[model samples]
Target: MRLLIPYINAMIKLRLETLRLSVSGRITGTVYINLSKVFFPEETWNDFPLTIFNWWSHSFLNGNEGDYRFMDGPFYFKIIKKNGLYFLEGFFDRKLIVSTELDIDEFQCSLIHNIEILLNTIKKNKWDIDANLDIELLNENLCKLKKNI
Candidate 1:
């Protein structure tokens, strides 16, 4: 039974990371962000969907004072899907902070697929990139993952 639990966990982990080769040529970044309001389809295990309301990027550059500084990225989004049609689900700070349903449009589906690839690449090793801390990105990803019905 203990071995089964470990196997189940490993399977779930793999499922969360595996890229859907069937849906290629789109998606990017460290996390999945679909513009649609629905993350999971009707046949999904959960109710809430996935989405990304906004995203911020921080990059290192020379500041006006002759020092390196970071700048925030843009924050814009669209509704990709209607409801109930996504694979991945998440929580904030390890708790069910917010949840939303997503609907993946053509563009969003492409983006989510690419993001899965990016996430897999990042998991190969660690880097100094603050890809997870940008407010826009956090807000967007959080909004997509945890929005109320």
Candidate 2:
């Protein structure tokens, strides 16, 4: 039994390392909100920008992590990664509106695509340069448009 325990521990460690690698990135993505539920019922859904320069910087990413909260704007959300699956939870004034597992790769792709669209729109508007535009601020605004900052 003792010998089997060691093997089990090693396997668990390896699995954890792989899971960590899967999510190891800048952690940029937009969290969509059903504003109709939070605000006017006639309104549709909206996206909220979210970004973590280095998600690993958070203590939860270290080991046996707990829920990570998002406390910005009128709404709130939480992110949780368990056994390699990433879950996002959305709330409005402490009431849960949505909870679902997210595919990180897909989310990243969507984020990048939205960023490209933003860039193109800027170029189309001839606001790419000489407008004294703040790139960082533009990025933030672009994120708020549906991607992450």
Candidate 3:
């Protein structure tokens, strides 16, 4: 999948810092966001049709900030928008984890790319997505964001 609008060369990337064994169709790995200012981040997980990434796609794609808290039990992050940029102030289990910022459009592109890569990873691993609601929503968001791009 590709973005409908050409990306504006943002200095942000989402890489699989580490990958582990698959369990129940979920690819467990570190969804590392390589950006300019994010520090002490701990964004890893099961690539199941879960809430984390889907919620992220929903929030940023619609130009809205998100507050995510689900993973390692208390994984949390809040995306704040300011001056045409987005800031993330987050924590894992009550300990501050992610604190960072990036351009708004770039942030949306990053989010769209995350879903695209995760979906690719899912397909590569031969995980089933016949009825996964999270995958469905993610795909919808991906397409929607791409079209407006």
Candidate 4:
């Protein structure tokens, strides 16, 4: 029994190490995915611009470590587009990362490719930027002040 326990622990460690290596190492950045702006003006339903119907950042990362499922986190947002493409910008982890204006009909495909590349690039490049996560985190409190009209 003792021998098996040690083996199990070793396997778990190895698996975790493998996952870490497979993903970009030390990848910490804010990722922004805009849903409607340039190409999807009519598609922009409700007041939320960046977010689709239920696809909040808190629920976006189904497989990522930051996936909060139902609990709303500070990182989730839906920006208002006044003129140009409503951008989704924030300091993720610590690095400044931005998503291309996502109005392409095939957004699902582009999103996967873009995020994969962005995370890898940030992980490899190790950019030094202001922490935007704090802003998102803080927004949670201020958002309550808005009138429910």
Candidate 5:
């Protein structure tokens, strides 16, 4: 299956492209989503690897609404579920940037794919990346999420 989620009038196409790890263990990567060119960091951000996303995935699975701020900046993403549909919205300084709908299974796949990207990067590099990565917990959560998908 392709990574691109169908971008209809009100649908979101989001994905993460993991670049590399810094000497300090922060993830340097890009978030690929609709209108992401202007908002996300050019190459990567000096941010925790997969930590926010792991939490976001877990919350998305268990809750009806949740919000996440990006790179400690004004950019934020909020997810809300109603009538069996998921609404994904992005905001900057409380001003709405974009809003779109995501499919249930599509979002699950997005989480699984993102987790795999981070986990595989660590595995392939064979770096002592766990000091800040918390890999064991990520792997555990990944397994549980995979079973659901």
Candidate 6:
């Protein structure tokens, strides 16, 4: 059991990061104000269904900054300001997960960062939508965004 722990952890990390990239699609260049709202909303996980909402609500209620868990693995996040721009960064077990730069100013950055963090957490956990939820529209929107990118 002890020997399998490392392998299990690595597999989980790979799957989670792959899902994150799939959802976020490796943003490049500067994200303007208009696009920022679309890509990184006030609640990034709002588009997703109930599991994500549970995760977000738990995180929000706990107020656990810099340290969180997804799929039983530890993760961390931070909102960084550099050159008058904001960046939302994610890390898994001290390894870099993603560093997304936002064009928004410092004032509005935290809200976006909070949402991004939650969204990433949702992706990391591989939460699936329930059958009752209308996920087609969400999939369509994500497809459109991917095509635009």
For residue 18, give model 5's deviation from the true position in Å: 5.5
Clashing pairs in 3: 5-149
Model 6: worst 10 consecutive residues (lDDT sum): 3-12
Q: What lDDT score belongs to each candidate, Candidate 1 first?
A: 0.26, 0.35, 0.57, 0.27, 0.59, 0.34
For residue 82, what is the lDDT in candidate 5?
Answer: 70
Which residue ranges in model 5 land beyond 4 Å of their true spot? 1-18, 35-47, 130-133
Q: Quote the lDDT for 27 in model 4.
A: 25
55: Cα error in model 4, Å: 12
- Could you tell me how far off, in angstroms, the CA of residue 104 lies in candidate 3 after the best superposition? 1.3
Please give the distance, in angstroms, between residue 128's alpha carbon in candidate 1 and its true position after superposition: 3.0
For model 4, how does the per-residue alpha-carbon lDDT over 56-139 read when each residue is reduced to its tens digit?
A: 322323321122111223332222233643323322333333233223223323333443344344347564324335334324
* Model 1 regions lying over 4 Å from their true place: 1-104, 135-149
- Sequence-dependent TM-score of model 3: 0.67
| Candidate 5, 62-146: lDDT as tens digits | 6627875555556667777778777676666777666666665766676677778777877787767645446776787788888
Off by over 4 Å in 3: 1-14, 17-21, 35-40, 43-50, 83-85, 92-98, 129-131
Ranking by TM-score: 5, 3, 2, 6, 1, 4
- Top model number, lDDT: 5
lDDT (tens digit, per residue) of candidate 1 on 9-128: 101111233322223322222232321432211112221011121221111011101111111122112222224332222333233322333232333334334434345444554423
Q: Name the lDDT of candidate 5.
A: 0.59
- Model 1: worst 10 consecutive residues (lDDT sum): 1-10
TM-score for all predictions? 0.25, 0.42, 0.67, 0.23, 0.72, 0.27
Write down the lDDT that model 6 would get. 0.34
Candidate 6 C-alpha error for residue 9, in Å: 29
Which portions of model 4 show Cα errors greater than 4 Å? 1-25, 37-105, 122-149
Model 2 weakest lDDT span, ten residues long: 4-13
lDDT of 3 by residue, 55-103 (tens): 6667666556766544445655666777865666656666664455545
